[model samples]
Target: MVDMDLLLALASHARYRPDQLAVAFEDERLTYRQLERRVSQIVAAFRRLDLAPGDRIGIATYRGVDPVALYLGSQAAGLQPVMLSWTLGPALPEMAEALGVEHLFVGAEAAGLHNLATSGAQVWDVGGHTADIGGFLAQSEAEDERWIVRRDPDQVSSVEFSAGSTGRPKAILRTVRSDVWNAWQRILAYRACEGDRWLCITPMNLSVLSGMVRAVLVLGGSLVLLERFDAARTVAAIRDGVTILPLQTPHWSQILEQPDLGDIAEPRLRTAVAIGQRIPVGLARRITAAFPRADFVVSYGTSESGMITALSATDPAFGTPSCVGRPLPTLEVEVVDEGGRPVPPGVRGDICVRGPSVVAGYDPAVGPIVSSMYDDWFNTGDVGQWDQRGYLYVIDRRSDVFESEGQLVFPGEIQEEVSRLPNVREVAVAGVQLEEECQATVFVVSDRDNPDIASIASIEAAVARVSQVSFRIRSVDRLPRTLGGKLDRVALKRGQW
Candidate 1:
């Protein structure tokens, strides 16, 4: 049986390895013992506030130690922690009200935002010389006591909002059991060890970030936290013995553009896990060349499901185009047609997953929005296919695919193919609706500031090889991406290009 109390496990590590580093930010480092003490104080503070079981606590803080401590501490005190992204800005107040948040912790930088006052909850500022609430908490009397709240396994522990790339982001629920299982799955997939040093560059609001942090802590590993992603700084950290790097696809792209990347020799870097979206083969190859010593992994998952599939460096599908690897050992994955029947290998279908890692359902206020999809199996709303060897290749989101001349065309596939062009720097492909049909349009970011006609012709030729439908090619300075670093296809289709 899995231990549902993650804080208790963290406390055990603190007792055994008091001096070991638990988390590091810039020049400041906190040992396991220190981290445990801080968490205990936070838990006591929550009790002092009279927060009860299931009371929602929202955290909208910059990437730092206090946010991590508050997240784990909230759950330990029997409150459901909600990770609210600072990017939500004006929309945050409504989201918090909908989630029934009673208390909110905002980073010092974001504390002065006007919408925060309208959240209808008591707010505390954390970090950066600000008179933060965390600093006011008195240390608990018994630091070694097991202060973890005991609750039913299926009770919600954390609430995360979906990436609002398509529309309004929905609140997804995660139980203690699912959270624990997700951590274990990540640990197994990454082969994380007690001695590993995890570099956390993504925002804490992301589900992947929480899972990565939990996996490292559960395995007695240390986390190196960065307030924000800086390519040059990240490269330097890698050279300084950071072993595991978990980042989004856009982060990899930005890191590749850094001129100082080749100057760093990172022998300690073992794994670089790519989350958020599918990565093109050309870009993946560049990442592998840059970090020759590190394993480049592509992970597929969502807010509702922890990690459904992962492409490991050692796996045969690592270099395969669009392959997200096989289903995780903890889950069952399937690709089915519109009728919900399983599709044969090599045929595209909606990807669905069901297992311990999948959450029970959304909160009642979300009102069955995702329950139908989450019934017996959760339809990911993504199109994918499995090879004969069981390797899964995610084509694109189901809605992102459009029929062109009676042939279903995936913009992701076209984008991937166009990205292989030697002169193309970045690319985004979207289908534009025409009379009675949709046509593919390719937007290219050329290596040269002004791509000549010849360069455009070369990209068109590359895209033509995999696609038979007619396509329009345009050169743009750069492609627009959502806050989470995913291509904003909805914006593209709306002619925001």
Candidate 2:
């Protein structure tokens, strides 16, 4: 039987490959042995603070080995780690309160009010730990005789907050078992093996962190963490032997469009996992052409579900350049209608997911949950349909669907076709009430050039080719979006400029 505690894996790896690199931060490197010793000390030190099992602890820090160490050590000590984004700003206090954290750690200059640190919380200055990591890890300490948690595969090991673009972000708790399973699945799908180095581009607070990091460690690989998104630096890290990288759509687009991106091309990269959103077809083709050594995977998942489905390099449909692909082994996906009944293949409906990784629930106080399923399945807010070959196709959110000319129009569908035009940089579609009744309106973003009647007519033709005949397209210079990167259609409908 597999051991329930994830810490044992780290301990074992440390003993086996003490000198092999376990992690790296910029120029600094820490071997598996060094990581284990440091984590042991950190766990023992926290135990001295009298923190009990199931206690929630918050860590406000940037991406680095120290933050990752705290995350691993907290779980080893039977504490739940809540990672707050560095950009959380004034909301940090409110978030800590919402997560019910009693212990907190603030890194560098990001620490907020001290009043929230309960009597149980022993805030540590990570800045002090950074200067002498070796000294900190080398301290001798007797093993605490405290009870170690034999984790249930279903029990949550960490909590990640959602971006909550349409509303306030909510804390999403996931199980350690699911984390391991998902990581393993990704490793198999991407063909990532030992010695592979991944440049982690997404924030550590994201739910994907646990799976991605665990996958790398399980394969005896290395992770290079970045503080923030920098196109040149990211490419350079890849050039310097980082084999796998998780890239976002916007950032990848920026890199390929930049005149200088090709200057630091890396040949060691085997694959690039593009998550967060669909990559524009044009950009995907360009990335593959530019970097022939690496394969590009279009992945789909959320904080609630780790990696539900992914498109591999060799799949026949991988070149479709739009679909997210078939579901993973552990995941079960269904396209359901408004009545919660399963819709037939080739028909659009809400995408419902059920699996080990799906979260149990969200906080009701934070916001209304309009998309959760009534049954065991977790309803993804997205509207999608399964093709004849069982490939899932996402249309748009149900709320984002609006009636134009007495028919339904999905913004995602229009946006996809509109994005095909060369001049269009970004596009968002919303329904506006032009008459006494509501009608569809499309927002378009183009560079410098004003869209003439001919250009507008061409867009109308494109919409007519795919959309319900009643809907019409409206040309606008800009569209609003929430901080989480989702289109702010609600504000647009309310006539907000």
Scored by TM-score, the top model is 1
Candidate 2, pairs of clashing residues: none
Q: In model 2, what is the error at residue 29, expressed in angstroms?
A: 2.9
Q: What's the C-alpha lDDT at position 470 in model 1?
A: 81
Q: Per-residue lDDT of 1-497 in model 2, one digit per residue for the tens?
A: 22233566666677787888887887667898888776777777666767776778877665467877777777777788887664566566667776777766676645554543542444555652455543333444635324346666667677776645554566666666656676766776566888798877546354555566778877777778776677788877877888887777766765665566677644788887777676667667778887777887888876676666888656778656358889888889999888889999878888888876677566454346554745668877888888889898777777677776667777777777877876776666777665577766666667435344227777777677778655555555566754434456667775456
lDDT of 1 by residue, 1-497 (tens): 43444776678888899999988887768898988887888888887788887899888875567777887788778789888877777777777888899888887656768888788988877754222465547544433455567877788888986646776566778887888888988876676777799988756365666787789888889888777778788888888888888787878887888777777753688888888688888888888888888888888887777788888777777778889988889999999998889999999988998888788777666434645364669888889999999999998988778777778778888888887777777788787765655667888877653364337677778878888888888777777767566777778776465
Residue 15 error, candidate 2, Å: 2.4
Q: Against the hidden reference, what TM-scores do the models get?
A: 0.92, 0.85
Local distance difference test, per candidate?
A: 0.78, 0.69
